[model samples]
Target chain A: MTKQLRPLMIGVVGDSAAGKTTLTRGIAQILGGDATVVCLDDYHRYDRKERKELGITALSPECNYIDIMEQHVNLLRLGQPILKPVYNHSTGTLDRPEYVAPGKLVIVEGLLSLHTPALQRCFDVTIYLDPDERLRRRWKVARDTHKRGYKPEEVLAAIERRMPDSERYIWPQKKAADLIVRFWPPYGYFDENVDNRHLNVRIFQRHTLPRPDLTAVLDHSHNGRRDAISLEKDVWSGGQPVDILDIDGTISREKAAELEQVIWEQLHFSDQLHPELLGAFSEGARERHSDPLALTQLLIVYYLLTVRKHRPVEIT
Target chain B: MTKQLRPLMIGVVGDSAAGKTTLTRGIAQILGGDATVVCLDDYHRYDRKERKELGITALSPECNYIDIMEQHVNLLRLGQPILKPVYNHSTGTLDRPEYVAPGKLVIVEGLLSLHTPALQRCFDVTIYLDPDERLRRRWKVARDTHKRGYKPEEVLAAIERRMPDSERYIWPQKKAADLIVRFWPPYGYFDENVDNRHLNVRIFQRHTLPRPDLTAVLDHSHNGRRDAISLEKDVWSGGQPVDILDIDGTISREKAAELEQVIWEQLHFSDQLHPELLGAFSEGARERHSDPLALTQLLIVYYLLTVRKHRPVEIT
Candidate 1:
């Protein structure tokens, strides 16, 4: 018997508040099996205490970029057979070292991946995200103060210190990118008078190298899943409507069982899903709950097959 | 007479340890009249003292990036600038603010400028400095330990803390760069085996953009000016070698006066000694220097022109 290894590497780069992590997770979910996400923010040369005592901001190149870039690139280039530094974002310190072996796909998202030439060369494909400044700032303001425990003033000062270095070193990498994704907040969600806008995933290399349209792929994968709805127009009173399967007593057990089988057949399968699919469906159901509609659809399908009960989605 | 206005906005981005100020001053010297250099570093929401107390790394976006970015971008975009933050890299604090109007070129360099899409769009051109990791680390260790009053462990720690943020937010911008510059240490002189390697400028840019070729431009501009050579390539080393032109000597007063005419004729148009032109030459010379080249070049240039009774480069 021969063991075949398929190695995959993905690089995501964007501004501080540009939703690189959110974007990374979306991709990981789409390609879900076993996924490990590593963020480069954990490798700061100084701790919060050290930065305060020394009246220095971490904007200059004098920070610990060399080690971070070196370690990340080395591991990535070596096919992910390594231990990576894990810093707790909440505490702003290093945590346990995590081991990441070569897998189907490895997604690395950070600011400086492309900053160093050696590191930039390690990626199979590179993505740079450009989001609206106002939206990003709002997101950053919220994330920093609420999630990261930073004061508004503190966040601002650090941004100032970092501006010059960022402009000089980082923004120029956009030209080298395979794709530049620009994100705007959902249009017309703010007010009825406002125009509804769609987020654009601009493929710069469209003429050169085109990947399958992510939205199309998502649509196909999500189609007939019993609960998913294509987000079209925003209703002020409520969000997008979802389909709920009614399990009725009038339906026979055999018909109900057949309905479950049909729903399961429509769902996408990962390589790791077991041959006996019920257990996999349960685990997948938990994840789909993160998106309400996904969970609702699965629940509706399960009701139709297991219990002949005609009931609407329970609000709770 | 009509007032000519060609708004110049210069954007500079580099990694935390990359040499930004050293590069900024290179352009400042050329445009010396009423020139102001503004650092976005001072706008950091947290001063060095506060960040250490909070025990949070200053480089993370959780700190004050939104305000700094908004203010800096607003000022530059509006052409109604402020006293930009003054972050003393040697002493980490916001000591004073200096007013900067839009110059022939307004150079803004820092880490997060590229991270912020709005800020990135504001720049006409962008640059990324790709320095050797080993060299940058050495610089960091030395600067953080000696000047910034950070212990080796502290410096290393701070760098580690900021690594993820830098990678996630900082490094990706390198792919969007208009110009990517990699510096190499100058080669050995006559003795090939003798490694007289000192840092030298090695610029890299895309074929689509106009290359910033400072050497060729300076060479042509240096004509008729005094020439000085370094004995050991210590650019700041004085008493190296100087060439002085002789047209006026100890002769009759009238004859000596005629020699001034001869000297002026040889160098035609005394108006050519405009401070702006000389300033450009000095700026170019300063950039070409490695460690002490600028200091040494000034010493040599000053000695030959003033003390040695040779042709002086006058400012009109």
Candidate 2:
């Protein structure tokens, strides 16, 4: 009998606190309740004490079971299930392996998702979160110090220790990305009072994959003018040619909806999908925010859905 | 009295045989009879014999009256008329000066159009033609050998002699362009049997100016496909970030017309302009070919008109 068609796989790779989980969460929400999510960090072979004794950070490939990760990726691509390992961040220890069944859509996110050529080939689409170093450091310190019970000094020290490994292994993976997303402050506008809501984002849509065209929605007069969103073509950075979509953190609710409307109109198959699920970030049990984040999530969802539609029909 | 508002100035700069004249001619046709066209080659102080005797090529700044060119550009910017010198290519000699008055639009085309900051600052828009070296050399040899009474070997020798000057003076002006246009053969299909009609063009829309949004009309899947046209984002060349719009030379007439119609609809004010006047190349008397050339010309016209719309109205 012919093999059954497997699930669509998307890989999200980035440095720690580079917003991989946030991006994956937004994508999962858009794909509805059925999409399965996995983290490659779960493949870690050493606990915190073991890593400390070995003098290697979790960012190093040597600290993880790369072979097992590759095997699991291959299995998932073939519609087979795997017992996935778990690394508990809070307790800094390894938990029991949990059973994971491939679903219609599978999102694999972690630092080393694109590390191996075999693993990279398993992804239908790949994204790399490349936020500014300063912002990423801030996010890491805040998360570790508050939620993970690590002191501020300890978090800073960990980041410093991981820098070498990140540069050697994690950063090079950016070259393999179909999209490189960076979040930072808008040019000439910087304030200490700014929060995540006030941060601007630059999404670099690479030629590795077909990108959603934003030319119709791009406002040419918006360059250097104050606009919540803008599209720039042919921006050169470090000798790489990239098209940039700039979304201001201060984008208004009305403008955000209008932008979403434009994107939604292009997604003819997404009518059944709830529009409200996009661009959402929750704080505790009560508060949620949406603006530029919603727009960013909407673009990603658009790309994923487009890839699905273009996939060749399989025979069983 | 306050100086009268000048006509819109557009500078088209490129190296020798880079299709600057063809592009300028198309724009002139689209703009109708009122646009004043000036060739900066008129500013050449030395004739062909003089340049040869001086052991210098016309590409050198020292070979041209740059001070006079700057003064004329300044005068044109203020809506004043100038007695512009004429360099007669047919006879390889300087001709009588002609009176030139600024009209609704002024197009200045030549090698040094953007060579000086003062001249560069006078234009509302600038375009740089950067065709492939092999294609440009072919165009140069064909044009000179056929029309200018030069032998094939003579044309090639002239090109070789001018290489250093072209590199030192002409190519550097590409960095100042708001748009860099390159027409070449599509990857992998190379044959001497192909003509100009089979050349593909990549237009790089830089972030330096506000670019018209073409997202709604962009066909992303056309990148590697056999589509007649496509737009790609985040294409890196020599490590620079750029958005590319590729127009296949083999694009069918129907497809070209359809693409032109889409662009024309966006140009709401061009109702009086005849669309047929675009993308024409002269051979003898009446033979004309239309394909991707027409579509490329339409986009440039669209951009020029858009810039005119945003220009602030002057009170009489």
Instruction: Tell me the tens digit of each residue's lDDT in model 1 across B36-117.
Output: 4555554565667877888766566665544446545545554544434455556556443333566544667777666677
- For residues A1-316, could you state the per-residue lDDT of candidate 1 as single tens digits? 3443334456677778776765555444433444456666555556556666775544434544444455555454444444344555666554434445655556777776566666666665666767666656655765688767888788777667777776775687775565555544444443322221222222233222223222332243232333122222222223522221122222233433444444445444423322222212111113211222222223222222222122122211
**Native contact fraction, candidates in order:** 0.00, 0.00
Against the true structure, candidate 2 has what lDDT? 0.76
Q: Tell me the docking grade of candidate 1.
A: incorrect
**lDDT tens digits, residue span B85-169, model 2:** 6778887776545557788778999989999998898888889999988888887887787677788899889888888888899
Candidate 2 ranges beyond 4 A from true positions: A1-316, B1-5, B219-225, B235-241, B284-286, B313-316
lDDT per residue as tens, model 2, A75-132? 6776766656678887787754455778767899999999989889988889999997
Angstrom error of the Cα, residue A244, model 1: value is: 37
Interface RMSD of 1: 17.2
Q: Note the clash tally of each candidate.
A: 94, 16
Q: What local lDDT does model 2 show for residue B103?
A: 80
**Candidate 2 positional error at B79, Å:** 1.9
TM-score of chain A of 1: 0.59
